[model samples]
Target: MRLRNIPGAKESLQQHPSIIIPNPSENKGNWKAVFGNDNPIHVEVGTGKGQFLIGMSKLHPNVNFIGIEKYDSVLVRALEQAKEEERPNLKFLNEDVEDILTFFEKAEIERIFINFTDPWPKNRHEKRRLTYKGFLDMYKQILVKNGEIHFKTDNQGLFEYSLESFSGYGMTLHHVSLDLHRSGMEGNVMTEYEQKFSRKGMRIYRCEAKFRA
Candidate 1:
């Protein structure tokens, strides 16, 4: 984060009491109500510093958004961004994604976004990746049939590995781009990391996986 965005950031995070999920399990099936919307729900896993979800919520008010992050420090920064944006349709969960199923019922989530997720490059830590089968299985339980997962990363290894994982899970793949910024895909929301890395001319890999019914 820039020094310009730091001042008053702490106070801004305290402003939205309802947006922070203190107990994720206790909020089971209550996410839609939290945003005060019955529309389709879109969630962002590992919302580092909050730029992506807040930006998306600002542009698309009709759709609801929930950002989940495990690190309190990281989440605090992201929460401040969401607060600064004053997004009515955006909320957050400060917990591990393993609790996502308990917080949402079957087919409750309509779309999921995983942007610049941890690559977990080591073979021993493969399960920690958000696209890992364990995590995908958990996502599948809550995602509606035809629900989709959007991902963008600069890691070729993770991108290739994730495509195989999605295929293994029988997902329908679309928009498989090895260099997203140069792929001519318009209307793309750039995350803080994407903006930083893309400026250095790194090719960004992206894909969307739909869990077919």
Candidate 2:
């Protein structure tokens, strides 16, 4: 997906102190202070256009939701959408996932959502996949014991690879679905890409994996 450059995206994000956190790394280990309550923190990596995070924040007001997106152009759209809704429990992070550890402390996050992440199809780029062991290890360091990663994708190859990766890492998988929309799962919030792809007859795969510590 080609993203058109959104002028002043960075500036807009900086201006919205209530919605986007500036220099989030400085708040590492003290995220609960930022939220002003001891609520379970759930992060959505690669939150495109912010639909899932926004919807989840609205549905679960007791849980704090953070949307992380790297591209300023893509994140700007989400920031704009968030402006329309007043969700105190929701926040956005305009940063790369590679520095994720620097933004939170160990066992700081309770859950992670990887919705329609980039497949990184090339075999050489397998390590870059969000479900790769390296990333999972990082997640384990930040996630509380029994915390789970909820993943969804329309790419079968990526889904298969992720299942193998998760299993190889000794993570337990549950609620595996080849067609999430047809699975009749309750409380599933559809992302923007999920809605688009499922509308075009694409098979949506989903699963939840946890590293029992």
Candidate 3:
């Protein structure tokens, strides 16, 4: 997706320190201090527009939600919408996922949500996929043993590739859905892309994979 550069988007994001964390790497293992509670923290890797994360924060008040988006233009939209609601449990990280391990120490994260990420269909670009083994290894470092990754996408090829990746990594899959909207699952928060795709009659795939204990 081509992102249109928004003027002052970076400045707007910086203004909201309470919502957008500054010097996140410094927080490291002190995320509990950042949130001032011991509530489990859940992160969304590519939180486009923050629709799903925002809705989740409202639905699960006890869980701390942090959204990691690299682009200032895209992240600013989430920061704007988040201001309307006073969510002490929600925060944003304007950083690349490549350094994700630097922001949080081992076992710091409880759950991860990856929704509608780029398919990167080329065979050579397989390593760039979020579900790639390399990316999964990064996730394993910070996630608690038995921690879960909940992934959703409209791309069938990526879904198939991810299933194999997860299985190959010895992760156990649960609640797998080939067509999420028709799966009768409750309390599923839909991302902006998910809603748009569903409106166009696209099939949505979803699964929850857990690291071995």
Candidate 4:
């Protein structure tokens, strides 16, 4: 699918180097240097408009956060929100997840967040799903020992598929909620899509999975 170019989006991202790191690959394994501290790094893959990541960053000042978005146009919106306050531990990556290994070394990440990603419900596009085994393997390599993946989605099929995929990949699941809003789970941050969907009375499924050591 072709994405419509947003006017000045590219220029906006370049203007905010503090919020969006320029040339993220240069930092590589030494991500601590970027934030000037050794706090554990937690990454949010596919951070659409950065609602949840930004909220989490505010809620946890001690933990460093990186939000990865594929497009500069969409990422600019996240940077806009990030700039609203002083978030020294928060940063944005205008890059693709397929090249995630290039930006971080083995066991460099403490945790990962996958919120309201595309389900790719078609069977043929199963591999494109974020929870697919291939993506999980990539995540495992970069995550620290017993690092957790916190995932939330509005699709039932994808939730079930992800559960099976995680189990097949030897990942342990915890806090699996079929309806997240009413589950009374604390510290729940809502993404843009999640907020919209939940307002319409749609069910939200969430789970935390950890890779085997």
Indicate which candidate wins on TM-score.
3
Task: Report the C-alpha lDDT of model 1 over 160-199, residue by residue, as the tens digit.
Answer: 9999999999999999999898889988999999999999
Models, CA RMSD each: 3.2, 0.8, 0.6, 1.2
- Over the stretch 51-144, how does candidate 4's per-residue lDDT look in tens digits? 8988999899999999999898788888888888768989999999888888998999999999988899899998899999999989999999
Q: What TM-score, computed on C-alpha atoms, does each candidate reach?
A: 0.91, 0.98, 0.99, 0.97
Ranking by TM-score: 3, 2, 4, 1
For model 1, the stretches where C-alpha displacement exceeds 4 angstroms are 1-15
Local lDDT at 65 for model 4:
98
**Candidate 3 local lDDT, residue 187:** 100
Q: Is candidate 2 or candidate 4 better by TM-score?
A: 2
Which whole-number lDDT from 0 to 100 does residue 161 have in model 3? Answer: 96
In model 1, which range of ten residues has the least summed lDDT?
1-10
- lDDT (tens digit, per residue) of candidate 3 on 1-213: 688999999999999999999999999999989999999999999998999999999999999999999999999999988999879999999999988989999999999999999999999999999999999999998999899999999999999999999999999999999999999999999999999999999999999999998
- Scored by lDDT, the top model is 3
Mark the regions of model 3 whose C-alpha exceeds 4 Å error after superposition. Answer: none
Deviation (Å) of 177 in candidate 1: 0.6
lDDT of each candidate versus the true structure:
0.86, 0.93, 0.95, 0.92
